[model samples]
Target: MTLKHTILLFTILIALPMVSQDTSSSVSFWNILKSHCGKAYEGSLALPEEDESFGGKKLVMHVRACSENEIKIPFYVGDDKSRTWILTMNDGILTLKHDHRHEDGTEDDINFYGGTASNAGKKEIQFFPADVRTQQMIPDAATNVWWITLDDKTFTYNLKRLGTERIFKVVMDLTKPIALPEAPWGWVD
Candidate 1:
């Protein structure tokens, strides 16, 4: 082969792996969730106090819709199927948003409230502080910070409102794959 062609081929070979390599820990975290696509898990609140909205209810999370840049997981609290967690990767940054809907599939006024990762967190965890939009939507939640931890055994979703007593935590067992739940409200499939 010609020297020019050989040099070009060598360059492509050297850059191929780098192109496919994870750009950041956020991507690694995304890959971890993507791996669990189409699966569902059961969870329970870890906080000592029982929450009225979540207490005494069967908690289930279905990792339903997944794509190259987004994953939508429907969170079922007993018969209430009004919440879904939407995670999207944009320009190497991961953003988490909550989609709340009514029984008729209508968007809730307090929907899409979440934040983007402040930095590239660890492969197993990422933290999202309340964004400007979230602050505007829920002034009381301005100090809110949400995070998720995913590993082989457990996946936990947590929230803590800074300078307040409000906190929510739910831990799902990853090892036990439960039966898939129906799609959340406002979800087509």
Candidate 2:
């Protein structure tokens, strides 16, 4: 081979491993959740004190929509379809937001309240503290901390309202996915 061709081939070989390493090391919790796209799971309240609104109701979570940058999971509490948990990844950070809607396809007054991950969390868990929007939307929740845990068998959504006796948690069985439910409120199809 000519000297110029040999140099170009060597340069390509040296750069390929770097590119692969970057991709492998960059996998985050977002990627793990995205893998279960199009699946739905049933979960139960993990905390002793349940919110009256969600108590005695069937709780379901459907990883309904997924893309490179976002995953929208509709959380169904009985027949109510007004809640969707949206997780978005941008510039290596992940943010969680709650999208609430009314039956008539109108946005709820208390909506889009969540926070971003503070650091590079593990592929199995992430913690999001209350952001400014969350604080403004609910003053008592200013000190709230939300977390999600994912594993081979289960996925858990948890919350703790700091400085108070408030906690909410739901653990979903990931191993056995259920049939998909209807679209969430305000969503077509």
Candidate 3:
């Protein structure tokens, strides 16, 4: 083989492993989320001193639906059943979206606001910065960064608005799965 061909082949071989590693981590993270597919976990607000909506309310997250490339989780706050989190995986990339609906099962005006993972995160955590759609729909949240951490005992969802004091976090105990709540609004099954 020519010297140039040898160098090219060496470069390709070196890069292949990195890509595979990334894919592995991403898939591992997906599987971790999938593992709780049929369970419901109770959570509590863990950040910010006070919030009108979430504070003093019973928080629950139901990993209600799962598919080969998608998972749907309904997040309930007390009596409100309007929020569902949808995670989708495509080509080893994960996208997070918030699906909000009204009591009548209609999509909210500011729905589906979330972001895609910037890189292959670890098996236990992933970060998603605000995407263009999120920015355009909610200008105040343009600098938002959302992340989730999961383990055998706990799962936490977190959010931070860069350059601001706005932050939110909810911690769920995975060791105790609660009874599944009713389906969120707009969920067909």
Candidate 4:
């Protein structure tokens, strides 16, 4: 191939990726969650300072979107069969409801409702406990229902939007530290 032709082709290849990157379709909150419907992510629940006295132990969250409106977060403490939690996120609110079933589907904990915010990523929402019934909750970190925002082209999940490109860090209190109870679902040579 001629040098000029090769150079032109290389430029196109590099520019093509940039063009695609700059023209990504705007992703919506609902759509983003929908795409992660059947996927589970291993995450740790942030713990407080050792001397803070929160006493929340480590755990592993089995986060899965059971349906379009429901995300089920099941967790186990260490490798014990005794301590477990079944947190349900319906619509946009979360409740620490108990699962009366074994991992194989046999009954266990008492079910109850709890308070959570419409946007879990909001700083103000994380600052204080919010009651769903009362019209009082954290203000919007940004416009729309997006729990996350794009800042300088980077995805910022937990933020309090003051304005464009301005955000406050969300201070989330840990109910428990979600540790890896087992190895990630898949790994093989």
Candidate 5:
């Protein structure tokens, strides 16, 4: 009823939304990726390389599975559906892992290799450094670093070998989503 109490109440009401917005933006990178669930995007290789495995192939990524704690995006190269990028959030830390599988619904020997974000990234970008599992699986990849950027128009995945000259980058147009591709290898449904 008093002017001072009324002013304080108004200030608290105005500040509540700002606080929630700030928390959401801190995890916006993950939420942005999740927003594309059930949708697929086409992408192209951004780096020129001699590796023919990904050459002349239509690359597609489907935001196939999503949950509060994790998301699994299957990246398809032409007809090969053996790759899935898994993103997980645990106690504010975001982690990335590559899930590779065979056609017979079996896991590949060189699978589940990736890293965790070193800090709280921005709303549009997050970086991951190679984890211990990656180092043990591929010694040369010990210095690998991967980052993903998401925005209203584009979603880009990038990689770098800290001590080497190897780099891989893929940019997907988020503005133009494509048809969903087949289930990734090892996916039962």
Candidate 6:
């Protein structure tokens, strides 16, 4: 065979194994948030309190990233109709803002930070929200927080259900990438 053909054959053989592995399923929190369009997700963050059931109150997420530098995650929970929140998770931390008007489209609950994943093996992550504020909790005393994770085929988010006497936590699991989103401002849309 020609010398060039021999060299090309050897190069292809060496790269075969590496090319076969589909490891790109692993995505970062920043890209995940910035990829949202007009999709609305219906899920609940199950509160861990004995007094409150998993679906007690309501936990739903609305996503939007209309501006160039933003990827917004808006969260709502429970019956007392506690303040809504817009969240951004990236750089290993979660930033949160409170939205009290519920109609005026304002952003509040503002806090930015970095936190480590306590339950890494369980495909779970917990991030710091703010200081001296009341968040959701379980009767067993687990602080409800923003949790993120990615598995072989899906991405998941868990938000704690914040309340006064009820103090509980809730979880939501999303199974579709097209449904979950990849950009906060939704570059593709």
Q: List TM-score per model, in order.
A: 0.87, 0.84, 0.88, 0.34, 0.85, 0.43
Question: How would you encode candidate 6's per-residue C-alpha lDDT over 1-189 as one tens digit per residue?
Answer: 999999999998987875332222222444454454454455554444444433555555556543443445555454322343444433334444444432333333432322233221231333443333432222322344555553433334545434434343444444432244332221234
Using TM-score as the measure, name the better of candidate 4 and candidate 5: 5
lDDT of 1 by residue, 60-160 (tens): 99999999999999999999999999999988889999999999999999999999997778899999999999999999999999999999999999999
For candidate 1, list the clashing residue pairs, or say none.
Answer: none
lDDT of model 1 at position 66: 97
> How many clashes would you count in candidate 1?
0
Better of 3 and 4 by TM-score: 3
Per residue, candidate 3 scores C-alpha lDDT tens digits across 7-92 of: 99999988785534357777988998899999999989999759998999999999999999999999999999999989999888
Q: Which residue segments of model 5 deviate by more than 4 Å?
A: 1-26
Residue 58 alpha-carbon offset, candidate 3, angstroms: 0.5
Model 6, 185: alpha-carbon shift in Å? 20
Q: Once model 3 is optimally superposed onto the true structure by TM-score, how far is the C-alpha of residue 128 displaced, in angstroms?
A: 0.3
TM-score for candidate 4, residues paired by index: 0.34
Q: What is the lDDT of residue 18 in candidate 5?
A: 48
**In candidate 3, how many Å is residue 52 off?**
1.1
In the predicted model 3, the residue pairs found to clash are: none
- Whole-model lDDT, model 5: 0.88
Residue-by-residue lDDT tens digits, candidate 5, 104-169: 869999999999987777888889999999999999999999999999999888999997888988
Cα-based lDDT for every prediction? 0.91, 0.88, 0.92, 0.35, 0.88, 0.42
For residues 1-189, what per-residue lDDT tens digits would candidate 2 score against the true structure?
Answer: 999999999999887855322222125567778899999999988885557887778999999999989999999999999999999887677888999999987999999999998775777888889999999999998999999999899999999999999889999999999999999999998
lDDT winner between candidates 3 and 6: 3
User: Stretches of candidate 2 above 4 Å error?
Assistant: 1-26
Instruction: Give the range where candidate 1 is weakest over 10 consecutive residues by summed lDDT.
Output: 15-24
Candidate 1 structure lDDT? 0.91
